[model samples]
Target chain A: MSMFWIHFKKEMLEAARSYKWIWVPAVFLLLGVMQPVMMYYLPDILMMSGDIPPEAAALITVPPPEEILASTLSQFSTIGLLVLVLSAMNTVAGERSNGTAELVLPRISSVLPMMIAKWAAMMSLLILSFVLGYAGSAYYTSQLIGTLEWGPMLGAGAFYIAWLAWIVTLVLPLGAVLRGPAAAFIALGSAAALTMLASLLPSHLQWSPGRLSAIATECLTGGDPSAWAPAVSAVCFMALSTIAATLLLKRRPLLPQA
Target chain B: MMEPVLRIHNLTKHMGSLTPVKGISFNLERGSCTALLGPNGAGKTTTLRMLAGLLSPSQGEIRYGNSGETGADNQRWQKRIGYLPQYPKFYGWMSGLEYLIFSAKLSGLPGKQAKLRSLEVLEMVGLQEAANRRISGYSGGMKQRLGIAQALVHEPEMILLDEPVSALDPIGRREVMDLLDRLRGEVTILFSTHVLHDAEEVCDRMVLMVDGRIAEQGELSELRAKYRQPLLLLEVEPGEREADWLRSLPERHFIEEAEIRNRAARLVVQDMDEARAALVREMADAGIRFQRIEAGASSLEDMFMKVVGA
Candidate 1:
């Protein structure tokens, strides 16, 4: 729809002007590149620290490129997810609080297109940062450690992105009802709880989207873990959250609280 | 009556326990500029928000044009109306030109037409020179002008502005008021303001609201004549004797209401000529050193004060 594009273009322009495009990907890249380089230089870094003797330092062995990339995915799950959620937390909440929505909402009959455009814009940023960071980590892993298989590496990246996608999408619905930082905090907390639940009873919660992280790591290590259940659920979760955000926004378009 | 451009029947909004807009209704003519005049917390903003479709009414209906159907869920009416809040805020990072284009596009204007209209409205609001400048750097007046421009960019059938000039400096107020004056008859406008002088200056009609209800609404001329009353203003030299004479004048048979402050006394009287003659003769007999005496009709301000105070 043309309306979606118009709003999407505006969102992207806002992202650019706010320097989100620069710092977000840059943070991801730093997080990604740190994983493989740190693993490769563990012995030397330990030696320079003067905390370990030479014989103990010699015992440190470099990890395989697949394992190193999997470690990079873990890093993405922590600091990288936090950065992405922070970037997206203000998408709707900021507009509502700053009084911009009062000017913008009356022009359209429904809030669906605006919600979709915002979600798409956030997704675009998420994919861009994730691709750049994952690629940076892959390139560093192949050079400093061992060559990675293109097939499994791309699959692992896709799975990891899906896992991050659903978590970041939580901010959309949460932001509609709560303030920005509160939304971000709740989204992150939900992700932590879901992942813990999945781990505690892996058989019972096999369909949980939280299992995507582990599935991604398995794919990278040459294990063909089942991805269908979590993938389908992650996509459904995203669609439902977007709809929830649209409905909540439609109910109270002007002020967020009352 | 060419079927009023918009009609509302007992619209109300209940926010939690506070009902800001109690059930009230009014109609707007096709090209008339009507002011929604009220004191603060009189539900002007809540009413405008409901008509603008930002907030759904808890009761009643909004009908647009000749159609009997409610316009609440109609996209056609949504595209035909523009709204500016009491505090109009924009994306500060966006340039004025960009914001206008964005707004016009959202109103369903095509890309080329949106751009052209954006430029036209920018010039109309006297912001063409600042089109490329970011809005955050704009002065308060410039921002208000841009708010008006964005509201006009879509060429909607009507615009609802809440307290449009209430927050401006004197010069800024003058500029916006003049702009509204120029915009009269070109588009229907329903703007809310507590300043009666503003409504009197450019609006042809007024809907004076008090305590979430319309106290009075009619053509400006009709309300002026309806509220018009004989008034006598007498100013005497300051003295205990003159003050006593001024205070005693209020108790006279012809005087209906009186407000005496220091050396001046404003008396509302049944007969202006009789009151003037009696006051002049009394002051002369009492040897009162009166500086000035004037007879006139009361202003709309008195009606406004009376309605709001009640």
Candidate 2:
């Protein structure tokens, strides 16, 4: 446990020094605010472009706060998830390639503590960025569109974070075996494929972690979707990936392979 | 005799099709400094990596300490070791001081002791002024110094350094060599280097490796005395007759081996006095216009070339 803290502190320090702490949250905040603001001005934006008749523009109704917030979760699913994965993609791969692992791995008996610490640090970042982005979206939606209940908003945010967390966690295992950019690309690609599969066969894939996103959106729009199966599966996926990463790293601690 | 601090029994590593370290075994005494000497691709790095516990051996075992502990008890034993890779890399975002402290802490030092040891190693490596600066901006020499500092910060019982000073400038090399000299009695140091001079400067024992095998290993003086032979270096005025005479000298009864260039020949002889007398008399008879002839004992460099070249 003490060893975990030592490695965790190092990971946090690296994140801070690299400005990952700042830029990742900033990108999330930008994505969060853009959703509600853009939806509020869609009618005027169309009229100004002169692409739609005034009658057609008037027919465009601003989405409710719940719907706007749900769309913000979608934005998080795409760009926000990308930013988080990009920030995390190098966590293990960079250390291995740059030869830092050669220096550190021998000091500790097992790689499990270090892997756990890294995962915790990444989780801390993901949680911090998600909370800020989702809060900003809720605040903007309340002021520009309509009022929202804190109960559903917080619950929906939790579900969305779970969805993002599992996908981003894939980078850890992938990064153990591949380069940083390749890990990030495959992580995002897997998330897309899983989501597509879940939608294509919802009855068969109800427990897919990909369903958390849709469940989050449903929770926001006042629909009570069953969140247990997807949330539990997301946690399982994260845990399994973290273990897989640890095992892979232990097998080849200095993986600078091209 | 006390048990060796570390022992290896036929350690081997097969990475894909290339077997870098092929069934090599050696033991390290508790406080002695040994140099792992080898030419490039001699598996020095691979051997050091296995000893450092970074790479698991494909076969055989590495036993540590007086108890002859093996991999099952690695964590406790690993704390007693400090390793520096050939190209030691740190988090570039970290300052030299921070990296040292981190290393010390990871080695199981208490927080306060870790800080004090960090500062001590920083001063020892002469990185006190640049301790706060990011490592990304450090020069190669400074980084090398930091590598040494981190290796010593924990005050481990043994240190495994892979090519510790191979990348340094002359002055940096001198400083590191001096540091290793100072560290000799205090800690068990096993450093690998192809340069025989560096090993000769500080190490008492030498393990010469070639092609993933131990070509020769023993006390430095013992190996020197064993391989030492009477050598004759003859440099003559450039001429076809002189070159022919130099070539012909190797076929003499007293000469064991001959390396001939256009105007120079290095002759290893079976008997120094007989070879010298016969060569001089032959030169006088043939009227060979030789510029210089010197008889001396062969150096370790010659043995290194012989081991590595073969």
What value of lDDT does candidate 1 attain over all alpha carbons? 0.91
TM-score result, candidate 2: 0.97
List, residue by residue over A40-103, the lDDT tens digit for candidate 2: 9988788889978777888898978999999988898888888899999999988877778889
Q: iRMS of each prediction in angstroms? A: 0.7, 0.8
Q: Whole-model lDDT, candidate 2?
A: 0.90
Cα deviation at B45, candidate 1, in Å, is 1.0
lDDT per residue (tens digit) for residues B1-310 in model 1: 4458898889888989888887888999998899999999899989998888888899988888776656353668889888888888999999999999999999999999999999999998899999999999999889999999988999988889999998899988998999888888878999999999999999999998887888899999999999999998888998899988887876799999999999998889998888888878887788999899889999899999988998
Model 1 TM-score relative to the real fold: 0.96
What's the CA error at residue A196 for candidate 2, in Å?
0.7
Off by over 4 Å in 2: A48-51, A256-258, B239-241
Instruction: Give TM-scores for every candidate, taking all chains together and pairing residue i with residue i.
Output: 0.96, 0.97
lDDT of 2 by residue, B46-142 (tens): 9998888888899988888866465566667788898989998889999999999999988899999999999999999999999999999999999
RMSD of each: 1.9, 1.7
Question: Deviation in angstroms for A97 in model 1?
Answer: 1.2
